[model samples]
Target: MDGISDVAVGVKRGSDQLSTYKNTISGTDCMNDGASNGSDSKKLKVDAAPPSRVLHIRKVPSEVSDAELIALGLPFGKVTNILTLKGKNQAFLEMGTEEAAITMVNYYNSVPPSVRNMPIFIQYSNHKELKTDSSNQQTRAVLPAVSTVPSLSSDNQEAAGTSPVLRIVIDNLFYPVTLDVLQQIFSKFGTVMKIITFTKNNQFQALLQYSEPAHAQQAKQALDCQNIYNSCCTLHIDFSKLVNLNVKYNNDKSRDYTRPELPTGDGQHSLDSAVAAALRKDSSLLGALNPLSAAAVVAAGKVALAGQPGVLLVSNLNEEMVTPQSLFTFFGVYGDVQRVKILYNKKDSALVQMSDCNQAQLAMSHLNGQKMYGNVIRVTLSKHQTVALPRDGLDVQGLTKDYANSPLHRFKKPGSKNFQNIFPPSATLHLSNIPQNVTEDDLQLLFTNTGGTVKAFKFFQDHKMALIQMSTVEEAIQALIDLHNYSMGGNQHLRVSFSKSSI
Candidate 1:
């Protein structure tokens, strides 16, 4: 493959050169296009890209497989190769020519996107745009920090277009929707400004406000026909009907809107509780390491950043013994442990965030690879930088939101110093000695493109393991076949595999 090389060369160079290694630290390598040859191969033909062009696309789906990216991006021309970064939600679409790259960018930017559920941002990569000392200098144009939390108010800020928001009507409401449940469902839309439920005879009427009309419409679309608590508890949704609060109390629209089949405590229900049980049954589900208590893990992660508003990881604690929330108190001693993260499997391994760069440096100078919980507690900064603060910890809303708007919104440097190995494990992909030009996103995108339909993709805070999820198991096998010794971008061959996940 001409104009193509992968990570092996860079990984080897990195590990060999850096006495001070940190997966969290990003590196870059200028093109050493030594492998491009004029070959008559069709595979090479389909894969060959112009000797010198790069595509810059944003607002791509996170779940979109690397194959899909190739499919979507290749239309611009044989993408000699494409790369996306997991740290931020964006991709580096290197095309056959600057013309091709520019053509692709303008083509997409001309109209509303095909898969876009939200607004999209994209453009060409100008060399002069890059900043100094940053591994991800290519897409260095500042973007909004990753945030998916829907707005809290329902007012139509947009006097124009909007997505639909689901309309919900509750029937057998023995109790009004609690704040916990309200936050759970409404937050998914954006943010909830207000929720009100009134009851007279165990039956309740409720009004829910979502950030956008589209979100309300979507909620109505999916949940309208679905049951709420269980199969026996059917839910009714009304989209066109809203009580005219301006007029006197009205009973017609409210009652006719929907009906619920109430339960008679002793009655048998058809729904199985199996799904809930299954999720709870597996404690080692998320990744190799159990994440610390949601609250604590986020706090430690935040503090590790030294006041930068972003997500954090906690390490150096066992799920079987101590609770992640409790262990975070110890991190608080270092500073405001914004968030704490515990690995699902790497017991005692944790990640913590401080309030500012100085604090993060303090913890790093004092705590990198410190021993704790029968294992060494690794402490370092995180790469999940964001321009704006997220709505909350856990990064759930942020990750989803980043996936929606633009893939580039995914990475931010608010420039917090990234925490390296808070919990370094023996079983990990050791990528180092990278030319100070290689980036975490570059490495991740390489494997994902070659790896097939990545089901879930994550760069391990740094580069320990880029956990991949495939559309099907077969793609994983195929990726393995094609990747053995195959090289890309920086004269580097990739290390690809299917192993234990973040769990």
Candidate 2:
């Protein structure tokens, strides 16, 4: 252990001060020459060797346990053997295959492995494998039992890269997908042990772990490239690199079912609160299948709409053209509009109420930055619990209106199909419920009359449904506001909403 002196002295000065920590310590002969040449000679040896099954790890803290070192290699592949040089503060790990070793090295090269918050170095070892006598007590102690290590067999790994965990990416996510939704969907196949949801590369992604690898494989096979709802919220699933997930909190973003007593963490609401609220309200807003029970829908709503209010404060409107009914119709594209109150003095501003917080959140997410009546509108959660009506005898240009019992509420019915087709506003609009007699030219003329350009149009195989692309999103918004529930001949009202697909 020639380099032992440098590392031992560096350890005293703290890991931050170790500038030569990146050097790879090879065999006995190199370690013998390492003290004199320092990092320069070791750096040459580091690049001289090609990929191998054994990886040489440097700057391993003496206090770090064998299990910690093994855990580092577990994510990449199986760790067959390990040999720790306590005096040199280094170790050599033997992966099950050379490919696994190369993957580990490449990954660590960018992310850089750390144990106990201390940075460590990993590179391919010159030796292909570690040779240790099976009779040696130390060697026996270092080898982990196959049962304890959750490594996939080579056959299973080659077949589908099977693991106990799945990585899920949600595409075209118009409606919020909560952790409870994921648990309910995956638990139908097996026991969902844990889940972690995050946003990466501008996409909503999740890591879910099942109690068994077979469960994960089944769920992946069934769910990959499938839509969570009728046509949107597509799920792209694959086997996660991780064999298991480490969930620290039982909150909306992450959960550990085995450890239910864990804290919800800061700024997070407990599942109990979400479930209690969901039970008291309608559960149709969550369109995902609930194999667990109605309670899962409640939990999904609570987590998805946590901290959101049922009322929205809208501002910067076109005062001359904006109206209570117009605001109700526009916002109703995303939720059931309950009430609307246009500020009498500030005509450009208004307060809109939805059936519940989930609806309000959905509306805000979609229409906050959207254009309305030739002006960009701003939508935010209102501090007021309810929009107060004007005095009984007094009327301010009839600005406020109550739609609590209005038949136009799209999400009023439980498990409404309307919940499944929600999408963010786009230039293309999905038009449905068209009168059979209404021709494409008639619809095009109607939308064009709204002072917007009609880019393209295509009727579905069933002429009752069609896609219309406008010159811009603003023009489409204007068309939707003007024509959503417009009366067609024979009492049929046209239905309009944003479409995820282009014509």
Q: Which pairs clash (backbone N, Cα, C closer than 3 Å) in model 2?
A: none
lDDT per residue (tens digit) for residues 150-177 in model 1: 3434453442124222234444221123
Residues 1-503 of candidate 2: C-alpha lDDT, one tens digit per residue: 11111222222332222223324334542343232322324532434468898887777777775546655665454556666665667777778779768867876775677775567778777888665433332332233331122334455545444578777787756566766557645654556778877644335677788877876776665566656544556677767656666666776568876666667674242323433342234221213433332111222222234444689999999999998999989999888888999998899999999888767866875676578887878887788878887788677488999998898888878777777677777889999999889898999999999999999999999799999999998999889989988999788898998887887
Please count the clashing residue pairs in each candidate, in the order shown: 115, 0
Reference-based TM-score, model 1? 0.19
Q: Give all TM-scores, in the order shown.
A: 0.19, 0.48
Q: Look at candidate 1 and tell me the lDDT of residue 134.
A: 50
